[model samples]
Target: MRESQPRESGAQAILEKYDRESQFRLNLGKWGLIVTFLGVYLTVFHLYTGYFGVLPSQKQGAIHLGTALGLIFLLFPAKKGMQKHQKTVPWYDIILAFLAMYISYHKVIFLDSILQSRITGYHPFDMILSIVGILLVLEATRRTVGLPIVIVAGITILYTIFGKYIPTQLLSHPGFSIDRIATNLWYQESGVFGTPIQISSKFIFLFLFFGVMLVHTRIGAFFNDLAFSLTGRYTGGTAKAAVSASALQGMVSGSSVGNTVASGSFTIPMMKKAGFKPEFAAATEASASTGGQIMPPLMGAAAFIMMEYLGVDFSTIMLAALVPAMLYFTGIFIGTHFEAKKRGIVGLPKEALPNFKKLMLRNGYMLLPLIVIVGTIMIGFTPQRAAIIGIVSAYLISLIRKESRLSLKQTIYVLEEGARVALPVIAAVATAGIIAGVVSITGLGAKFATGIIALSGGILPFALMLTMVACIILGMGLPTTANYVVTATVAAPALINTFGLEPIAVHMFVFYFGIVADITPPVCLAAYAGAGIAKANPFRTGLNAVKLAIAAFIIPYIFIYDPILLLVDVTIPHFVLAVVTAFLGMLAVSSAMIGFFVSNSRIWERVLLMLGGLLMIHPEVYSNVAGFLLMAIVWLLQRNRKNGEVSQSAAV
Candidate 1:
């Protein structure tokens, strides 16, 4: 077994580095209460909206953005390290916070009146507000989501102005006046109040609030325990448990790093103890945790954005995601099993494993809320209604268990925490609105699609490759939610319009690659955090994570090639066929990648398996047959090798 150190820095250090949610509330007592009050207020506002639909879209968006922006300024420091030990709000931040409030309140004060005035042009006050709003949103985005998105948005704004000078007329615009640009971005429905922000305001917060409530009620722990009990007695149990546990946890939790730290702290050490290398252990946790974003039921807040973008119900996305997401986790599990076989590792001792039956009996109630949510949604309840009921039912279930029950104060904290956790998303979504607006106003989405199609020579495969690369690059520092919004806005149109691909397929395609960035090198935030906990080198861990998640990289292409994988335009027979071949493809790919199947694979065997998997993964019957034959050949060879070795041993 390779020697591995315990985490050098504790959870605090890992969180501060990777998670925006770990920021200090405040040092001053009064300021702390004030911040808490604001958080609670935001949560309540969303809850109120959910229960009783209040106000028009613009008004609701204004209230939501205003509240979130104010809290963001109050909570996140202007400078990073300054907030480490300091508690008091800086005077500048306080001013900025008030300015954010003023900006949010602008829609309330001016929007209806602007409409009533019948004036299409920007007044002086409107211009100032627009300029201030843009600057404040940029700074707030910098403080919350980091500089990548801010820089992107800033460049877009510059392009919106000076773009006409460029030779290309498609993306470039006739130079716009400052007043016109400000008026459009600030006041237009297409700007900060677009679908992204609108969805963020309406649905994302409610779901996140429910998720926080679910966590406070101990569903996360139940999930981890549940996974452990089910998988702990199997080969490579600890690592398998990580895959299972991360999938279970991800169904409810939205944040990748949060889930990584939450589950990795338990699974990574167990994997290391089971004799996995530190890099492999860390990478396994990262890959598994990052997968939660793609998992169903609660597949992060981005799914809500997709709901709006695709104009489909949540069930459609959930059903579509079911097969591919499972294949992703199964691939990881297979890799772990093979790695364990290669290392001569075994499952936990019977005495060390949790009792699966007892765990289910004791903690089964913890799943009631999820069941209620899933059932209600499937049975035709609105998602918000389902979530509200889930929260209520979950709270009631919590009352039955001492460990899971929440006190009144604790419940309030849950609400506050939920809203606090959503701040960065609010900022990202609103700022994403700016990008969407720019794309819409400048016709950049169409222009980019045309250019990419031209570059790709109108080939579907080439268009997909270009989109995948774009998603991976854009997703480097952004959250999955923001990553998808930006990618779909800029890149999805290329695949859909250029290749005449389905919207859902293109969206899912970009979404998968965007999320793969979390486990991809150089900026794999989830992988880095997992490595921090496993005390391994971050880059190597990220690479290993990429290897473990090979299925995610490949499965998207499968779904894109055959929308049957996405349950689009599908018959039952076709869906099953697509699913079976895809599953075999995953198995084949995992076998080749891990260099093991029925027994250890030889080099030529591995190559054969790879060839077969690629063929089967494509949706052609002849190719599938050819691929299966190649795999069957490899499997028989491996079996023969194992038999020969056994015979030699018997002769000895």
Candidate 2:
């Protein structure tokens, strides 16, 4: 009924303008200022640490607390409104911000010389600072992410405090003293400024900065232009373009829902104009956008976190991620192609499509930064150093074209923008650190693994199912990085302990599921964002996204079962076999979902095709042979039906 109300284009224009202005102000001031300072601060600290490593845990805690608090204040709004002169800062906000900074900055005051000389010890001032910092972090987390993560964090923290009173199996040693807890959380390396914070400060920020520099160099736009040139004249051109653009966007943006909203705004309308149903259009965009987080080069912040958590080289993780990432995009692209065929959608006119040579000539330089980044990292520079080099290269490359020039003001703007984007991620990592701290202190990770193993009867599939469910549930509320952190700590070890899966494979499995949650139902934010643009039912769009991304859900299991897909322990022949089988499996799954191969498939055909896909996914001689046979049957039947239909139509 509400949808029946007449809309005013002028009013909509005013609202859009208002929102843009408000967003700009928010980005430029609070979010921008804090992130810029944090970037500079962390860069300086890292440089100093690299030259002269400090062992002071309290000092480390202080730095973490300060950065976290700064992010909280800048990234989150005290309240939402449009009044230009309205005072957005509340009294409590000021109190908390100051407290967080004080606690972190004055960590030395809290420790005795012995504690300071050995492990960080409790000082009175440190106690006060820790309390304030913790409170601020909780409040800031509540404001930025949502009540769910804060509630989860609060419950976990509370459980830590009250473990002594719990049942035997769930309990821990009569837990830490309040002062000790504060000191550990606020001053120690195990707490606020631990691995998560270290990863965030050292790796995540540099990548975020790299993304900013890439954007300044017009690399993202070049990607869009390249996609347009490549796909703008194919059948269902807009949707194809959306897929290409989103893949490129995903490589840099690292936020699925954000990427969906960004590229979807353009591609969705174009799709609708090209005769796609609104819901299908939205689903296409959402599913494609969500796949971006799993894209190679950069996967949300999870890739960096994975490198830290696994203690593997960045290049190793990137190399391992390649096949799975390709499989993800391949599935989406195949699914979209089938859907286009089913609907008989047409592409853009030839006149509107960009000339390939001309487009490449203009934009080829835009790709140099990414090339340099991968090359430098492979040549053995630390990810941090490589990222800095990439950032510099991006800036330098921007100067080649007048349109992509990065002025001094724009450089500051990019820094500010990069910082703004990095804030929520910073908070998520810091909050996730609390979960990691709890697991480390209580050995709860091992306990949880034991429980999962017992429940799963040590069966690999059962354990994987349990892990996937946990990931989806957690990912419904948390960002990809936090989701990966929580699941990797809890479920990854369970698979390793129970199923004997490698640590890297187990972590990758959890990470994949966590990122897939963006398109999963109930709380599929990327799908919902797409629906908003398409004016389609959000639930329907989400369901469609799930269907479209079914391969992503299944492929992780395949990789876990047969690590060759992830390039683990493989001969050349085996690797080739795995690639061929996986490709066929994806094609089968896509065709089944779309119900169109050469023509419309019957119910039996669909079921058989799906079975073939499943068989193809599992690595075995018999299953692969059976899958190939079943696939051939479906193709022959579809071809026969299509030829018959054409003959009949010709007669008519």
User: By TM-score, who's the top model here?
Assistant: 1
lDDT of 2 at 273: 87
For residues 5-111, what per-residue lDDT tens digits would candidate 1 score against the true structure?
13335876897788765654446445667777888888888878888875788888888888888888877887776665664777787888888888778788777
C-alpha lDDT of all candidate models, in order: 0.83, 0.75
Per-residue lDDT of candidate 2, residues 466-524 (tens digit): 88999999988887888888888777887887778888888889998898888888888
Quickly count the clashes in candidate 1.
1
On lDDT, the leading prediction is 1
Alpha-carbon error at 185 in model 2, in Å?
2.1
TM-score of structure candidate 1: 0.96
**Would you list the clashing residue pairs of candidate 1?**
27-87
Measured with C-alpha atoms, the lDDT of residue 546 in candidate 2 is 80
TM-scores of the models, in the order given: 0.96, 0.91
